[model samples]
Target: MYTFDSFKEVIASSNKTDWDKLKQVMTIIQTVQESKDQALYDYSETFDNVKLDTLEVMQTDLESAYHDIEDDLRAALELAYKNIWDYQQSIKISDGEASELYQKVHPLNRVGVYVPGGTAPLVSTVLMTAVLAKVAGVSEIVVTTPPQQNGVNQAILAACHIAKVDRVFQVGGAQAIAALAYGTETVPAVDKIAGPGNQYVALAKKMVYGDVGIDSIAGPSEIVIVADDTTRADFVAYDLLAQAEHDVLARTFLISESKEKIEEIQRKVNELAGEQPRAAIIKTSLRDHHYSVHTVDKAETIDCVNFIAGEHVSIQTKDASSYIDQINTAGALFIGDCSPEAIGDYIAGPSHVLPTGGTARFSSGLTVNDFLRTNSIIALKKESFKNMAPGGMRLALEESLQAHHDSLACRMEENK
Candidate 1:
């Protein structure tokens, strides 16, 4: 299905625009304030087709959901919770003490987590955010999601219950974000918000970013597989499908030098495509964004992979571990065929929520660190301040800030 375009051609085509939907979504966000809660309700009916009564989910409903869920599914969710806890528990940093140095680690007082609700209930995402925040020792953790026609999804409620979230709110989209950011009559303001959602939610997060803290304004899901002759073509095809099924705008790519390998994977993609339930979405996503490169050499293939810097990078080359050492970007790197991108999305310890749209170049995936902020704490004994005053005054005067120099000099004089 991939064309034999040169490197530049592939890059150019990848940057091509289909901005009609993006523009419309932005307009919806811009017009949100005119209606407020009513606007969110309208979008729920239009986009999610679910009408609402009370906007917040209750504990009674959550307990009922936990009890209604099958024991097997509950067990699996519990296992995932344990795995995430074990991984994130290791991220603890001892609260730094202040002596002479001016750096300190401080935990945020409260944090809010948003879980996607429309199309599918993303119960696993609840685990991803809550576990990481809890590990960071955030004092108050709250969860927000849209209500379904009947009520909040049982699985999502169940996940919140297991995580022991301090509060659960029935809210979504810009209104939910605005509530968390500004604090309305019912919802409380939070220090940070983290999760994944459709474009409206993304734009809303971008809008409310400065008012409150956020993990990132995440983009659509992405996966880039670096494969060679050693990789099984079936595995490659399935890995691409795993990310592509996430959204219509999701991007998936394969970088390899072997023509036979590319052809085999393409055939497998077609065969597998026929059997998937989300075939229509996956097919459109593949046709629009998926491709295979016939790189000149292995080094060239690695260079090509780095340029993409996808949210998820799967290394299935002959020496995948060695290649992993060479690459410096990507939200998360899957070492071998057994570590599929899908596993990381659910049961794997690391966060499935990651930076996207080439942001892995600087930003990182969600972790306990995202929920906490570091403060710089500094203090000096009276004698130390007296000794350091002359140098500090000299620098302040050198910069022409006489007020700064005078303040230190005056303090030193008073001590003397």
Candidate 2:
């Protein structure tokens, strides 16, 4: 069982920013920028250790992917697609307060989604990123995933089909980010790049930030479960492992007022984690990243939860919904016993692409808002224009922008 530590100290240690990796990541990005598709071929051989005949997966093969995958998976993907799109549509473009000057919403023309082909194929990510873009009316959505020994995963292909992703590329890592940002012969330049990837891919996104929009500097997946006496130790244990199974660095924590309750959950975690299929991964993840805290009271527990700002927060405490407003930093909240973070990861309406690394303090999970850009529309009436011009010209003159003031003067003169 894991021992409880000083919550502040444990949270501080998790901030592992690798500035050294910047140079190497930049080199990979530059290589793709210069070599284009041939660079993709070389990197495929060098990093992925798989040779590729073509950069893009053919359209026919993409559409036929549904037939190749299992019937259950296809059904699941289709259902998830509909749910995700529905959620996105619900939150989109509601300028309830009509004004003469309002925002004009427009979706990005194209986006590139990077699906990691590592430990798991991340088939759900296909729906999370692509379908949301589709709902936002993005013209084209392309996906980039690393290839496995047997080519792309059939389920991933099936997901692409279900999500209606326009293009699928067999490229990944920093090179994939580079190719997406600065187009290669096969992969066209995208307006933005979405989806999560490994550290190199994350660093590449950081490098290409200005050239193309990225969803976020995604860190490992995490979940923080707050339990009370009414909470089931087994449920908390499994939820902890749910996040732990993601990666060795994935964070999990149990915070409760009673030390006995925390200990019981830890004990349950030990018993359940070993029996899991990803038991080896779960063990490593817990040993490396899991933390425990014993809060003196409800106020202390709330403070701890806000400080961590976990990607997913599950409350099993009594009257959980009443405490929702107190914890303001979580990326997604799973309230009550029946609602779990795992549901949010899959069938839940919202995108599972939430902020990690305590960034939920300042950011939010992916949504239709992330895909939509807003432009201020100003068609000022003569009265409003006259009202604003005097102040605007005065400010422009004070700021030493003579041309700006002159332009406003010219307009005013023409109107008179």
Candidate 3:
């Protein structure tokens, strides 16, 4: 772990776009574009070691998934769905209209949501993206996930059902992103693509950005906890360990004014990591990515947080709530000791799909706005146009555009 005396000493990469993966991702995308679903099948077999005859997940599969999951699991997912849906409604924006100018909000015709199918099933991801799209009133929501032995995971399918996803495709990785960006024979093209995936998937999204809108190029999961001497060492250690378990690249930053507190948390992290199931992964991540920063006071702690702009910021100081407004750049702020970063990953109302690699500096988490498009309207009467023409003509002439000047000039002359 690196110990930094000041926030300026803390260093982080702003954009984590892997240019090295571009060549491989480009090849996959090109093959998908040429061979279409055939490439999807071949890649699935090559990577996932599964041979698939069909690409789409049928309605029967979804129904079977509902029956496959346990009653308790289903109930938990149902509650999470409602919570996410409620949060989305609370923050959704409305259309505005006036006498002459207005903005009309329309949902995209169709959208594609990519959910990474790794060792553990990402059921919450299915709910996070698809539910937001559904709330936005998207005409059709399509989900693409890595194909399993049966098809998609049962829990994930149950999530798709709960979110009212229009369709599901048994494809993942770069090829799935390619299929979404450029329509193939089976997988239809979508207006936008949103979700979290591995490096290949992230690079593919960057490659196909112009072809389709993407929520954000999500990086490794991360969390920053600003704890002072008053903070609980166990709570701070637990939060940091949870972050490291995400992956080898996942980062954890602990900023505190007290050197003794930082040392206490570090020791606790070392002790707890030994007992964790994903101990190896967590240890490797902490060894390489973890940083225990020493600051002069609480203000310096927050300054370092804003500088890093981590995905999750858990303020565990004496009065954590007082610093929430000061943290201008976190993807999501957990403003107390009780709110662990894990809660936001699942049961919390906000979508855990967040900007990483210091991208919270500019981009935002997935929301209804990602699926909605707005267009501005302008309508003016004769007097309104006449009143506005002279100013418009002056600027046009100053730019030496005679045609622009003539367009407004002729309109004013005709109106007179």
- The 10-residue segment with the lowest total lDDT in model 2: 1-10
What lDDT tens digits, residue by residue, belong to model 2 across residues 1-416? 23234668657876876887878899888888888999999999998899888878877787788898778878888888889989889987854345769877888899999998867789899999898899888999999999777889888888998888899999989999999999988999999998887788888998999989999888888888888888999888989999998887788878888788888998898888879999998999988888888887888888888988989999999979977899999999999889999988888789998888889999998888888898887878998898889899999999999999999999899788
What TM-score against the true fold does each predicted structure earn? 0.91, 0.96, 0.96
Q: Residue 244 in candidate 2 has what lDDT? A: 91
Per-residue lDDT over 1-416 for candidate 1, one digit per residue giving the tens place of the 0 to 100 score: 34334654665555433366556555665555455556656666776568876566777877888889999989988889999999887876665766865666778898989898866689999999998888888899889898677778889999988887888987777667766776655667899989988766777788778879998888778998887888999999988887778888898888888888888998999999868888898999988877677787878877777777778989987688898777877899998878888899889898899988778888889988887788876688888889899999999999999999999999998999
In every candidate, how many clashes are there? 1, 0, 0
- Candidate 3, residues 143-254, lDDT tens digits: the string is 9999888667889998898888889999989999999999899999999999999889988998899889999988788898998879999988889888998889888888
Error of 1 at 368 (Å): 0.6
Clashes by residue pair, model 2: none
Task: Please report, in order, the local distance difference test score of every candidate based on alpha carbons.
Answer: 0.81, 0.87, 0.88
lDDT of 2 at 118: 69
Better of 1 and 3 by lDDT: 3
Segments in model 2 whose C-alpha atoms lie over 4 Å from true places: 1-5, 94-99
Better of 1 and 2 by TM-score: 2
